[model samples]
Target: MSIEQRIHAHYAGLSPQERRAADLILDHIDDLALYSSAELAEMSGVSRATLSRLYRHLGFGSFTELRETARTLRQQGVPLGPDGDPELSQHLDQELRNLRKVLDPAGDDRTARAVSDLAGARTVLVVGLRNSHPVALHLKQQLQQAREGVRLAPLPGQTLGEELVDVGPGDVVVLLGFRRRPSGFERLVSFCAQTGARTLLIADGTARRHASSVDLWIECPLGSVGPFDSYAAAMSLVAVLADGVLAAAGEDGRRRVSRTAEVYAELDELDLR
Candidate 1:
């Protein structure tokens, strides 16, 4: 595992002081090579002793060792947050690369497989929390129009376990796992697998480490030119996936769309002004 993976894996077990120190390291990863243990400890509001212990807890002998590892990661262009002044042009370049990566042949193949699974499944469950909610909701709406039994994870104050109790063969679960995810993400994936549901993850590269858990993952780069991570790639992926689902659904999709239109017309939901 990489340093980032190690940190993420052990994050939940970290002490309060260790977590604060870890956040500082993750936020300023590019500069980790520059700061001394004392300086880092001061920045994180912890003692130097605590800082030393933090490295050991993360499986390093010393802070210097950890810094050296971080330096190597920086050299490899592992995203280490914003390093300098952000420019619109730089941001646009990164977003363009992200979009291209998603449309590449390998990415297209993965997307096609996900769409095929969804198109043939008896139930499609779209899930996302926090910033991912919009994408999940949008996917559910599109899939509802394309097929039957498509819905977002229900929200009647039910635990995930309760909601998934009936999920078995022929069910598809799509999870949107962007940065700053909820605590129960891995649990959700694991539970779905245990219930015999095929799982697909649309997420940032942060999820690459969890690849073995899901049937397929569409990684949308979240690099940014500003304070916030960009979502242009993710949005593009959503559109492509929806298109793939429609194509795979074929005549069944057309019939579902017609049914949906009939219901909308009967309910007077459309204002054709």
Candidate 2:
């Protein structure tokens, strides 16, 4: 079992002070590997002996063993925080590398095919869950400016079935599936297939297994120097896809954008100041 599992299994038996330390460790689990026993004890307002006892209760023979377990989890791609804060230059270099993969010329053909479907589809549904939601929503907003049929799926307090039930041939479903996707994600893809809707999947490397199942797949590298996955490349890809859709839309897209600007002016909706 992992450190987290061990903590939970023995949590009820821990002394009050040990529980305090355990709680602190759980709260910052991602950074657990980066913290020394002394740092954790000081931050948790617990004695070093309490922290040592907590480690033993959590099934770790020593604080070093606990840290080694956390490091092992990190090596298995658990998104543990880096050993030290990354320098700005290092972060920039990593972002640039990710952007290069996203903007690679080899993927242009696949992108064009996706844009063609988005431009021509009778209905377009953009779906995302968890971290992918913001990217999907942004893409939906951009697509709406280009065409009339764009829609966002599973709106607040909604479920996918309600939006996907009506999808069929001539419709397009764009799925933004980053890492840590829900277990049912593959099932949703299969359902879209059953509806005969064209599917476009934009995801990080973790979703590669599902690539062959979709009509088109765009891989966005999300490597980051910090604990959380970076979405800069994903967002850049959204911009590129939106631009392609606008261009493919021809004069119609231009007219829609113009009309939207007019409405904004008429309602005084935008804060120009």
Candidate 3:
């Protein structure tokens, strides 16, 4: 049974003090991962004995077992309410884990395949709506220099239908799908799929349930590291994938990039000062 089920099953029978400790745990479960048993007891206004009893009631062999479970759940993308000034070390550790997950050997192989698909496409459209628009724009900017037919979807003041009119075979679409995805986002992907465009979705684990909407689903570690979901992992994936795409583009890509650089230099668009 899940930890929650165990807690609920034995909740009513817990002593009043034990119930108080239980309530404290449920209210701030995320904090438990970083708190010692004695610290948690003090913060919850309960004695160490009360915490021990609560853990026993919840069927945990020891307080350490409960804490370890909390850590595992959080790492698995479980919601832990709003982050509250976590230690800098913890944040760094989490980000390191996130990066490792994305850049591992298996992930590298998948990214290589994605790069191959993108490099062979006639046109690539990047779609980022709401909070994802900036990332999409960044991708488009980077890709435009490397390849000729990169476009950002839903151009300024235009609807998707108008933008996708020319979308068909030999096209690739990269989509950013973070939490609280915009309404109709799934339908938009479905429409792209029907038009024979290969759609790659960059999102969190939550996107697994909606797998059929896109041809490729790259899970980026996303969570509320602070007030918003940290995109460090997603951005790192983008950077690496961008490199992969450029590598696949080879000599032709280099030539296009050289031309773009010449144009930028002529216009003096860069600031070296």
Q: lDDT of each structure?
A: 0.80, 0.88, 0.80
What is the C-alpha lDDT profile of model 1 across 1-273, one tens digit per residue?
667777898899889999999999887776577788888888999988877877888899998789889766643335554567778788889889888887787545887788789888989988888778888888888778888898786555755655677788889988888777787888877877777889888887777876789888888777665556677888777777788888888998888888888999999999978
Evaluated against the true structure, the overall lDDT of model 3 is 0.80
Return the clash pairs for model 1, or none.
Answer: none
TM-score per prediction, in order, is: 0.68, 0.77, 0.71
Best by TM-score: 2
lDDT score, candidate 1, position 46 = 95
Candidate 3 per-residue lDDT over residues 18-82, each given as its tens digit: 88888888777655676789888898899998888888888898899998887666655556544
How well is each residue in 1-273 modelled by candidate 2, as lDDT tens digits? 987788899999999999999889888888887778899999999999988888777777899999898876664457888556889998999999999998878656887788888999999999999889999999999999988989998899889889998999999999998877888999988888779999999998888989989999999888888876889999998888899989998999999999999999999999999
- Report the candidate with higher lDDT, 2 versus 3: 2
Q: How accurate is candidate 2 locally (lDDT)?
A: 0.88
